[model samples]
Each structure stands twice: as structure tokens, then as C-alpha cells.
Target: MSSLLDLHPMTRRSLLGGLAATGALVVLHPFAARAASNQAHLRLMETTDIHVNLMPYDYYADKPNDTLGLSRTASLIDGIRAEATNSMLIDNGDLLQGSPMGDYMAYKKGMKAGDLHPVMKAMNVLGYDCGTLGNHEFNYGLDFMFNTLAAAKHPIVCANLTKGQLASDPKNDELFFKPFVIIEKKIKDGAGHESPVKVGFIGFVPPQIMVWDAKNLEGKAQTRDIVEAARAWVPVMKEQGADIVIALSHSGIDAKGPSEKMENASLYLAGVEGIDAIFTGHQHLVFPGPKTWDGMQGVDAVKGTLMGKPAVMAGFWGSHMGLIDLLLEKDGKSWKIVDFTSEARPIYHRDEAKKIIADTKDKPEVVAAVQEEHEATLAYVRTPVGKTSAPLYSYFALVADDPSVQIVSNAQLWYIKDMLKETQYKDYPVLSAAAPFKAGGRGGADYYTDVPAGDIAIKNVSDLYLYPNTVQAVLITGAQVKNWLEMSAGMFNQIKPGSKDADLLNLDFPSYNYDVIDGVTYEIDLSEPAKYDKDGKEANPQANRIKNLSFNGKPIDPQQKFVVVTNNYRAGGGGKFPEIAGDKVIFVGPDTNRDVIVRYIISQGTINPSADGNWRFAALPGTTAVFQTGPKGRPFASKVIGAKIEDAGDGTEGFAKYRLIL
Candidate 1:
């Protein structure tokens, strides 16, 4: 092969100049001159499901974690901007709530009229162009949400979230935020010629927010279907001269196709005509990745396309930055996408030894913006409440009765019993239902709750109960209670007899939905199929997974009424559990579940949060099943209640594998 050095001096100079003009080498100007005059490259950057992680710190763990933080992602953003000619940064929501900092602002410091939220401050410093609302934004109620959003420098749009009743025509609905915003910007083509471009940004929140935050929403707010809203607004944006339209869908990709008010409607929303690309979140999973959404119909996992339209879902807590690079060519007077690439760029990665390695440093401006609140949050979460006789962790929550959940259940049961003392339903037997929120799943191996045995702090309590949900009690018959357990049993997959190492837990079922009801005894029969699917829809009507169900040493009576202590989310039909809805709600406490946990801990002075042998799996002789949990669980494997667990090996995504002998 002939080298450029072998060419004549004039020819070499000409070739180098041509290569520089084609952006093959570093350009001296902001926009590199291109070989073609009509071509331009526009990069759309997305940070979704940030959940107020402004710094590289974990409030619950009270330690520095390199895997998460918007400040780290901000550094990556700075580099991404330099790589593209024209770029826009946007958030796909779930930004307002997650970390202790968000709780500190909403429940402790309280957001004043003009005060900027820490998350908003960090985002503003990074110059966010636009953003959207996630379901968690409604966790603290409308007043708190609006007060926090008021301080944002950028416009926040939500097409589906309505102030009151949704109108018959989606376009006429009284939207809580503007349906969409069009940004008119000057884009420099590859030839360095500036041209006007209109990019429309529309946002959507899951309609299920009405169910999840019923106490905060209820009759006060309503929502239109995501695809329904997109169908109504995308065309209007095109007609209004939008050169490109992007959907900021705070929803996940569900291959089940579109249904009425589906929670994960991003897949269907992408099918809406006139939508050029999409930014997805709410599932806390990345798109264009090797796993997740693989082999799903109408989904191009490797290409990051849903229904043939480009899309990206950045990992939650600022783990990754979703990027979509579009190569646009002038088609008549409007720009059309001729080529594109989608990616979920991470700020950190694991090394060969499974240690988290920081890929970028924290952006100073982003960190400085939230430094005050971050310190205050650390102080607030570190306040000692009481002491625990045993450690609390959620590593094996899915496969065994866990102490992490037991503590929450104990707190809730105590709180509910006291509250019902003066109520007419005091005579009803009380049971507490709690789930493991921080189990190893989409949140990754390090997401599990691990509180050491000793003094319990507010952060430890928060880790035990991840949500800011208020305690609520639902009155239902014993039959309905059994049905609820059956619904929760959907977390497990059916295994065949004599099968070796069959998958035990259902990956599609979220750990937070695997409610473990205290004050009752039950055995899950893995030999039987799950009666209900992850969505709480009946999958096998003949299946009876809940076996040997009993209460107070006797079989539960079908006609007997009981008071089930749970969070507002569950009582309001957040998980679609059978017979557990608004009508069944008997009591709604004023304090949050975390507050109750703190109070309970204080009252105990020294508590023993041990998991009682309340629930277990029915033994299937000669059968073996396997499950994955945080690698940290290995130390406590023998302490797990129920089945005999043995170390299997290393699992995917940094999770440790355990085999269950049945």
C-alpha cells in the first residue's frame, strides 16, 4: 500500500486538506467544513431517571459511589458536546425524587416559593434545554412538585398529565404543563453555513401515576393515554413547522403492545407518525445494550429502535447518558434524517476484578450547585434513631424471608395497630405487607440495602423503606388476602420436578412488587405455575401457588375480615394486586412509612429485625433452582430463612448466583 508520505508534497497537502474538510481530523473551528453543503450532524443528549443524584455519593450507604451521580454524567456531557457540531441536552424525567437529598428537600428543609431544588440547580448549571415529569415527581404531592419545578431554568413539558378531567379530545385537555415546546435554533451545516431549524420536544408521563400517587392526585388530576396524547400532538407540531419531533417518554418499552393507559407505553408511542426519535426511561434500564429488550418484537435492541424509530433509555441515577446522533440532509426546505446512531454512554464501568472504575470526573459546576443541599442531606440522613441487634440487607429478599423487609413490616404493623386502636376496625386482625425495594435487579448489584448491626440512622430507615409512601390500611376478607399473596407469588417462575438449576425468580417481576405479608404463614409451591403475571393479570386460573396458608396457627377463614397495613401506593392499586384498591382502604396515616420506621426504631431503643419463619417454599424433592442476588449476600447465605442455599457461581451483571435445594 502506498503511504501519504510517498505522495508529492502538493498532493499530500491537498489530501490532508480534503480529509480535514470531511471531519477526518480535528477542526480548528466550531463547525468543521464538510464535502457536502446540505449535510449536518445534530446530537441529542438525554439524562433520564436521575432521581436527584447530584453528586457521586450514596446517601443511604453514606459513602462515595463512583457508579452514580449527575455531576459525573455532566463531565461526560461536556465531552459529548465537543464531539458534535450542534447538540441539545434534555432530561426524560424522574429527576425530582430518589436519593435522600430529594427527601431532605421535600420533607425536612421544605421547598420555599423561590428556593431552587438541588436537582434543578445542578441541571440548570449544566444548561438543560428541556425536561419532563416522571411518576416519582408526584410522590410528595402537587404542591411540593410544583414548588420544586418552579426553580428550574428550563421549561418542563408533559403532554399526558392533566390538571383535572381529561377532555374527550386529547388536544383540549387541561394539561398540567405545556404539551410541548419548539426550540428554534441556528444549526451550522457541514459546510459551515448556518440555517434555521425547528426542533419540537414533547413529554409524556405514565398514566398509571394516577394509581401510584392517588393520595396526591385522585380527583384533582387526570391523564390521557401516552400514545393517545402523542397521536394528537405530534401532527400539530409538524404542521406548526417543526423540522424534527422528539418524544420524551417517561415510560418503558413493553412488547405487549399498546393498551388502555399502559404504564410502559414507549414502544407504542414511537409508532406515532411524525415522531422522529424518542428518549425513554422509568424502567431504569439502558437501550442499545446487549441485554434488556432483546428479541422483543418490533424492537431493534442493538440499533436502539422501537417500531423502526430511534430511541434511547439512559440507566437511572445518572449511570448512563442516552445519546442519539442524527445525520440530517436538507430535503426541500425541511431537514430529513439520512443516518443516525444511538448509544447509552456510561460514566463508569467495572474492571476485570469487578471494581467500579470512574470513566469521568465530576463536573465542578454541577457539584458546586448542589454542594450545600448535599451536605445538609448527609447530616439529615446520618441522624441516629436507635440501634438494631441484627444487620438488615435485601440481597436474598427474592428467595427468602428477609430482615430488611421484616423491619419495615414490623414498623408498619406497630404504627397501624396504634392508629386503629381508636377506630371501629380495631377488632379486625392486622397484617403488614412489605417488599424489598433495593434488591439486586435493574438497580444493579450494589443497589441492595445493607445496614450493619448497630446504631440505626435515618438513612438506614430510608434504606429499609425506599419510598416516601404514607402508611395505609386496607380492610379485606381472608379470601382476598390469599389472592393478594397469590398475586405476589408471581415473582417466582414455575419449575419442573427433578429439574436442576431451573431459574426460580421471574426477572420481569419487580422486587418491589413481591410483597411479604407478615402475621401470616404460607408456602409457595414452585411446582405450580404462577397464578398471576407480573402485571397482576391472571395467567393460570387453575394455579394455586400459595399453599398451607394459615394465620394464628389455624387455616385462614375465607369470610374473616382483616386489616392489611401497607403503603398508599399498594392500597391505591399501584401494583394491581387483586381486591386491594381505594375502596378497601380503611386508614391513611399522616406520617410517611419511613417516619414510622424511624419512630418504631426510637421506641424500641434496641430492636431485633430478624425474619421469622413466616413464609417458605414447599419442597419439591430432588429439584434444584437458582437465583441471583448482590454478591455481598454470600456472607449471609447460611442465615437466610427457608430453603437450603449454596453458592452456585458468579452471575451476570455483577450479581452472585445461589442454588436452592428443594
Candidate 2:
């Protein structure tokens, strides 16, 4: 084939003679040649961790959100696709469960065997070629996962998951889409010869599914590490005729390595021989786009040469799409990528003239559909569940035992008791626990889910419970339980107790989600440093801010055993909590904590959702109060005992102020 196309060293006269024979080619000259020179370029666009931003949907506002909709992304995708020589659209996962649409689509409306779930429905319309699964995919269990996947027109490829009863069965029919797929395309060579290129994509998720969603996976199947499975299969794909291999990882890129391979797998995965590029997500933080993974400063972990190979992890929740462009040199039997550029498709960009409109726009249909669902959800979410006799608050979460967290624990235990009726783990005494995922900083003063005398809408419930974390139970010793609280004490920045009011904590330490425990009583002595991490390493054992830990009105015994129930995020190593390790896990929940709360509310017919009031700070009597407030919450918060807004700023997020008045 080469012999037929090769041009031997020839005389100028011979070249002229050949060119004259093709008069049109001679006339076109460099104009035609320049276009050919740019032909091999392939622009790859990736959308990762788009947990239901189908329309310009916003769960917080409980309304038709116009800012964050995927429809806004459509215009960008269209413009990029129009300018590219060849391109492939891939979503990186967690498409099914974040907003009200997901909840409405899941347990409420319930998808039919062939019906497209709203997210899947919107994705199908967008025409995705490939995608992977974020851990959230299993939140609703396998049957529901498959039903949602079955609605997809694309391949749902992940190399690490086991389907049904077999780990290796081809018949497992695992995903709503294929686990990996290859796209064949043609590009013009330098001399106008048509060259065929095969771009292969392999998707992966963190293997911690065993801990994150154990109840859903325990009897159904298993999951393997992303790197190990990807390494084994990339070579197989090359053998099957792939030219360039890209990993669409639903994992994230992190600073601290080792344990969180899923978070920073790309760094090490870059060394994997057959891979050329990687697209990643799952941590919800964007990369190479104004973010840091731990101590590493300016690390474009999302865009880096991991082991000499290119990789990028897009930010989560449709915030950014990862883009990587590679130039390949045809090296006989294979194509070796010679140069590449990795970047995030930022939602907004300034033009050469320094103007900024939306760098993208919403897909009209996607916007319309998700908007319709968003409104319906709002109407449904607002209907009150019950009346609250008093306001619930989170200001004292980590510093003391919190009733806000206590409510979650009660709901989980309640849900577990009923779910266990027919399950094998029924005999165990279950205790539920949950940390606030969204307390204040992001949501402002109103962000704290304290409801005042009225019907509590589901939208309000979301603030009470953000994130769709399933109920997980870990079998822990009494000692480990105490250690968990010690780690939580990290939320407090130790100020020498009498040091004239040293700011001992990040006031913005999110209250609802970070609040510690409910089942036991303990005190955080303002004098100690946090025992654990910003990284999940061995926590300092001597660190002790918590004092007089007791359960059931007595000092707890370390030998006592109990199933510590919590969410998938915490159980799967989210906040570096102790005792929730994989070995100690007895059950991974398929039911979400929010769902449990909702169900518990329904069961009681009237929810007395009050804090157990198990813990409290000694007293802030001497310390001068300090906190800011937004226009919406300043008055109410200032009136509350020992609380006062000392300063304030308009919250860029819209309603609450970045208050600091103490």
C-alpha cells in the first residue's frame, strides 16, 4: 500500500509533468494544501459529573433555573462541533441523581422499562457517544440503575463493574450503554490520501462501591479498581484495532494520592501505556480551572501530563466540560500522540475584545423539559409535611452535639428498622448518623435548615438534607465511635482557651453537613487541634477535643458493638471519619438518607423532627460574637440569643449576605 502511494526522488521536470496532468491541483496549490494540513486534528469534548443540570435547573432555588441549565452548554457544544474536523461527545457520569428531577424520575414517577429517565432522556436527545458511571449511579439500586440505562441510546461503558451474577460474563448486559466503545472516522492525509482513525474510549468508576453502595451491590455483583481494570483492557482494545485510547473516568483528580485512586487516578493512570488521554470527575471540584486538591498549589490536576501522558478531569455538576486535543503521528502499525493540550470548557469565556456573554447557551428542548420538571417538583416539594414548633439551627453543630444531625440519625434508624424486616441483617441493633452536606456558607443564613412554625416543603427538606446519600451501616466498636467524634472535632481551629478570643474556627465551616453526632453526648473543649485530616491519613491518636463521651446517660464502653448507620459519602471515606472503614462495614445502603427522612415523616403522620439536644458548647459567654448576615437573615439571626451579625456583604449567590457581624 505504501509502495503505491510513495513518491520517489524525482526531477523538477517530472514533478511539473505530473502536476500538469492534474491541472486543478496545480491551480489550487497551497490553498488546497493548507486545508489538508489541518485535517488530522480531533477535538474531544467531555461532560463529566452532570448530576441532572438538564435544564438550567437549580435545586436550591426550587424554581426553573435559567443559569445552570445544560441547554446553556448546548450552544458551546454546537459551536465547537461545527469548528472541529472530527469530534466525539461523552458524558462522564452521575447523570441520574442530584436534583428534584432525579428524585421525581426515580421513586416517584418511576421509569417504565423503555422510558427515558429525564436525565437520560435529555442526554439521548443531546446525542452522547459514550459515558461512565459516577458512584451516585447506584444510589437507587441495580434494578433502577438498569432501567435508567436501558433508556439510553449510547453505550454505558465501565471496565471495573461486574454485572448480574458473573464478573466476566459477556451476557451480563451491564450498562444502559456499552462499557467501552470505539468510534471510527476518516481524515485527509497531507497528500490528500484518506486515513482511517479509530478512537477508543474506556470508562471507569471508583471501586469503593463496596463501601459506598454495599447494600445495592453485596449480593448482586462486585466492582474492581479503575486503574487495574483499565490497564488490563486498554491493551486488549489496542489489539482489537484502536489507534488512540482515552479513559473517560468518573473518578476525580486529587492532590493526596494512594487511597483515593478514583479521585486522582489520572496521575498514575497517565503511566498506563495504552492510554493517550483521560477525562475525569466525581469530586465536584473543577480542575486546571481555579481549584486545588490539598496542599498542591496551582496544580491543574484536571489538566496534567500524568506519567508523560495527557489527562484532564472536568469540574462536576455540568460546571465545565473537559477538552483535550492530541496530534498523532502515524507510526506504521500504531499512532503515537506527539503533542496535546488539555483544558476545561469553562462555562464562561471572555472574547478577544474582553466581552462576556454566556460562553454557551441552553439546549432549548433540554431547558424546556427540565424546567417543566423543575417547576412540577417545586410545586410538589413545597407541600408541607408538618408544622415545626420551633426553628432548627446548626450554629453549634461541631462544637457541641447537634439536634439537626440527630434528626437525620433518627430518620435513618427508623428507615433501617423497617428495611431490615426481611433482610439478613435484621437482627442487628441499628444506629444512624449523618453529617450536614449543606449548612450555611453556600446557602447563606437561610442555608441553615432551621424551619419556623409552618409546613415544611420538600424544597426545605432538601436544605435540611442536601445530597442523595444512601443509608450505610458500619459495624464499629465503642472506641472507634469516639474516634469518629475526635476526627469531627477537626472542624474547630484550636484557639488557646483564654487567648482573648482568637478566631478558633472557620465560621464558614458548613453547619448542616459537618455537624458531628446525635446518638451520644460529648463536648468540644475549644482548646484542642483537630485530630484528623484535610487528608485521610492516620489521625493523631492523642488529639482529644471531645470530653465525657457517654451514651444512654452513662460513659460508653469500648467493647460495645453497634451498626453505625450513615450515608454513602461518609461511609466511602468522604470526611475522613474513623471506624467507617470498609472492613468494619456490615451494610451499604441502597436507600438515600433524604428518602429515609421523607419516608419517616410519612410513617409518623406527624413528624416531631426535633434535635435530641445531646450536646452543647460550655459557653461562649466571654467571647465576643462575630458573624455576618445577608439582608434576608440579618434581623432574625441577630435577634437569636448569643448570635448577632457584626458585618455584612451582598451574597454573590443572590439572597443572603456574606455577613460577619458578631
Candidate 3:
């Protein structure tokens, strides 16, 4: 149990002299000597939030993309492993869903018990050491999740996910999988001597999965809070023969303080004792980057350190790979991490012109593994679904209630209107809430959904709805409905009464969070401050952004009860929307929103891609707000009669500028 410096003086000198004779101790450095004899370097590599991107191609666009895919990341992994003598590759989940490939497998093909899911098949070829599930993994239901997990060549671990419902076993008493895994690796010490190192790897998923995927998980599985699960498992991992513990957290580092339902809780997991290093994801953000996390205690964003422990969160969709290098020193029979570094490796880098250049090439071997499935997926998505009478696009979704969002809401209301028959909620007026899934933000200009006017395919359907979330209806009061719309109004900037030109859309607010209630007529006054903040907190408590709210050509009563059709993510508190969660949920349907859209399109024979003009911006005299959108939207500018759209000029970041008279 002696430290490297605590070695007997005579023994140390003899060791140094022998090495000096062999020209192995050129500088006779104190730490270098200890490093050669007593230390081992362990490199931990991670790929997270991959979301079923196996190839370097965008299935939605049916084109190649250098910025995404696990095949490109495989090249980075090969290069990283070559630099380090000892390393382990792990995936932080959300890999089974997100793209057309995921839908092709889950909905179209349907996975059987023995079938190899494309994601797992690709991971098996890449040689993943182990992985943990993310919230999206449960999007398809428990049977599908386990069936896909069974195809993995490597072990799968999740400490937080468990079995049963909240009322019966809220504690998450029974684990759904092995809590943690102890890996025994033979590594070279500073002096080239080999030793067995016991590395403990544990994993955790956000507890909110129970709510986010309630339709899939409710009675079948439950989840414990990430921090609580870490507290219980880290000690058990230490009690075993584990020398060092690494957490593969399928959670993000939210600077926001601890919450039982915090979607991103990697920061809290790192503070738990006995955990040495951590790999994080699910926020789809890169850590150790320029973004500063202000109030998080013990978090060094620049150094990628949390609670003084090394941590990394790779950006989602295989855009970046997270790496943690650990310097371990042996103390008698155990090993302790003495030093470490963390960083994220991007697949592509943007030049001065903002053109993305591939930083890593696709690995041929990995591509060869998933080639069959990739071709099959492309074929599956290419199958024609129906025809659109007009173009289905989302270029102006943020500024106006466009066709892209309306079609989704139309389908939801159509489905729910029929579903409510004979049910208790049948008496209430049914409304639908839908949001634009793609509006060219972090996803770039090409991210917008732009299906042609003629034929529509399954891939087009995936572009319309990015997630696999099921349809859900929540019974809420009219007052609660106003608060909900107020939350959606947070997507706009507060325009001054006489301002000449101000930014209209709050780019920081994701377009997906800007829900447009289809059945209600309302106006969002940009001159007033947002009633809710971007995080859905009541930032301006007295501010009222929603105005002229009415239903069925009459002023709606605040005490009136209404059923609003929406996705599971929103109803289960994904956006933190007020009065839209918990017991407020009246019905949870098994059909995904995507399926609903498909059914609606088929039922109508030929769909009309037109907005109903249910919502608009309230006029503010002498003020105008400038916004940015794709140039393609210019042609459809006159179609929006609610707002005065003027072509301003060229905008930054390759967007076309437009001035909207509020």
C-alpha cells in the first residue's frame, strides 16, 4: 500500500541504475521514472446520441453528409486507438431511433427476437465495449428495446432503468438490466510491465424516460433519478473488486440545479463518490467547448471537468466523439487515477466561408458491415406513401403557422376527434398542438422540410415528424391553455413599440418548442415581454403575450375544459410547459404521430398543404421585426395574409432576410 514516492530509497536507486544502463532513463526524471514503472495510461472513447446514424448519409435528404454517421466516427476511433496502447470504445445510447433507418426497421420491417437491428449490427462490427440506453431507446416500447439490445455483441448496462409503474413500485426497485460491469484489462505500466487492472463501468439514463415514453414504459418499466441511482450503485461497484469506476451517463450537463426529473443530470452523477470518469450525452451538445455553464459547482467547462473528475459529452448524431485519457497509478493491489484530460473530436470543421469540410473520412470496414441494411433502408423509405396537392414545406413555420406544422396538427385532431368517441373526454372540444420539427437552426439551412408538390414518400413522412413519440391528449382548462400558448410565444423577441428593425424569432429557442394550437384563434404580441422563458420558466410573470384568444368565433371561457392533442414528449414535460403534465394527461394512444400523419394523408387521397391561419402576430404600430429564413420561402411570402412580409436583404449564416410588420 505504498505510494510511488514511498518506495525504499535503495530499491529505487537500484531500479533507476539498471534502467540508466539500458538507456531507458535518459533524463532520470522523478515522475517519468514512476510513470515507466508504476503508472498506466487508459483512454476511454465514447460515441453518444448517435440516433441510428450508421452511414455517412442523410436519409431524410437521401444525400451524403460528411458531418454525421458512425462510419465516419469509426475512422476517428481507429486513429484514437492507434495513439493509445490501451483503450475502450463505448456508446452512450439513443442509437436505435431518430432517422429514416430507425423507422424502416421499427415500423416497416419490424424486429424479431433473433434479428440484428442495423444499429447494433454496426456497433458489433465497430467493437463497442459496452453501452447504456437513452430516453429515445424506449420510444419503440420495452419489447422492441430488449429485442434490439439482444443483438448487441457487447454488454449493455443501465443502472437507473427498472420495471413497474409509479403507484406500484416508484423506487425502481427491480433493475431492467445489469447495474454495472467490472472489466478486467491487462495494461503496461511505466516500465513496460503488464498488470491486471479492474475497471468498473456503470451507466445511467434520465429518469424522465418513464414520463417521456410513458406509453412504452409505464406498466412495463420505471426509472430512478440519475443522481439517486449513482449514489446507490457507485458504492456497490466499489465494494466489489473495482479499482476505478467510470460512468457512461446517457445524460447531459445541465447548469440548472438538481431536479428529480432533470433530463440532463451528468453533472450531479460526477459529484457522486467512487466515480472517477464520466461520458455524457442526450443534450446533443459538445462539452469542453466555448459555451460557458455559469452556476454549476465544480464544473470546469474549459477543462471538461465535473466535480474535479474528467467528463465528456460528444455532440449528437455522430458529429463528435468524446474522449477521456486517464493516468492511473498502482497502489499495492488497487489503481487510482492520478491525471486525466477530456475533449470532443468533430467529424467536420467549418471554414471561413462557413462551408463544412470533412475532418474524418468514412471507414470502409464499418461501411461494409452495414451496407446491406443501408441499401435496404434506402429502398424502404423510397416507397411512395401518397401525393401532396401542394408543396409541403417548413421554411416559414417559425414566423407563421405554415403547412408543415398544420398537417401534423390536422392529423392529430383528425385521429383524436374519432378516438374520443364514447370516452369521458368526448364531451369536451378537441384541439390539436403541433410544432415545426425542422426550421434551419443548429441543423443548418438544409434542415428544413421541403417535399415537392407531387409524390410523397416515407422519407418525407420522417422529415415531417423527426421523433417516434406517440400521440397524447391532455385535458386542460382555458386558463392553462393560455399559459401553454404563452410558453410557445417565448420563441419571439420582445419588439419595441417604435423599433425600426429588431430580430423576430428567438433563434436560441428551438423551433420544435414553438407549438401552434390548431383549433384556437390567438395573437402573439411581440411588443410585450414573453410570459415564459426559453426554458419554460415564468421569467416575466406579469407579461401576457397571448391576446385575442378565442374558439369557434366566440371568446373562450377561462374555466372551460378542453382536450388538446399533442405528442408524448410535450405532454410528459419534455419542454417544461406549464399545466400540460402529470395528471393533466387524459389519453395516451399507441399510434405514433408519424403514423397518424400517414393515415391522414391516405384517408384524404390527395392532401392539401395549406395553413388554416389559426394564429398570427398582433399588430404593433410603427414597429417591425426582422427575421431570417431560406430564400425558397420568398415565393410563398404572399401566401401568408396574417403578416406583412417584405424581402429585406441577404442575411447572415446563409439565410435570406425578411422584415415582418407586427
Ranking, lDDT, top scorer first = 1, 3, 2
As a TM-score, model 1 comes out at: 0.67
- Candidate 1 per-residue lDDT, tens place, 353-422, comes to 6566666677888888888998899998897757999999988888889999999999999887776775
Q: Report the Cα lDDT for residue 299, model 1.
A: 97
Looking at model 1, report the run of 10 residues with the lowest lDDT sum.
Answer: 1-10
Candidate 3 structure lDDT = 0.80
> Which residue runs of candidate 2 sit more than 4 Å off their true CA positions?
1-39, 63-67, 164-179, 188-194, 254-264, 289-303, 331-334, 348-359, 369-371, 384-405, 408-455, 462-516, 522-547, 556-606, 616-662
lDDT by residue (1-662, candidate 2, tens digit) is 01100111222322332233333223222222243343355667888767666765455446543335566665456555544455678888888876656766775677667776678767877788887887878877878888888877777788877754434533343543455788776755455566778889998877766655677887776676667777678888888899999888877654445443354465666567888888777665555544244345324454454555666666655655566766655777556666666666555433456443343456576766556666666666667655555555554343334445666777887766655555566775566667764455555555555566546655666666766455667777788787777666666566554454354445534443353565777766655666776444455657777788888789878888767787766776665566566567556554456666765665565556555656544443445323333345444544343223343455445543332221
Local distance difference test values of all predictions, in order: 0.83, 0.61, 0.80
Best by lDDT: 1
Order of candidate numbers by TM-score, starting with the best: 3, 1, 2
The predicted structure with the larger TM-score, 1 or 3, is 3
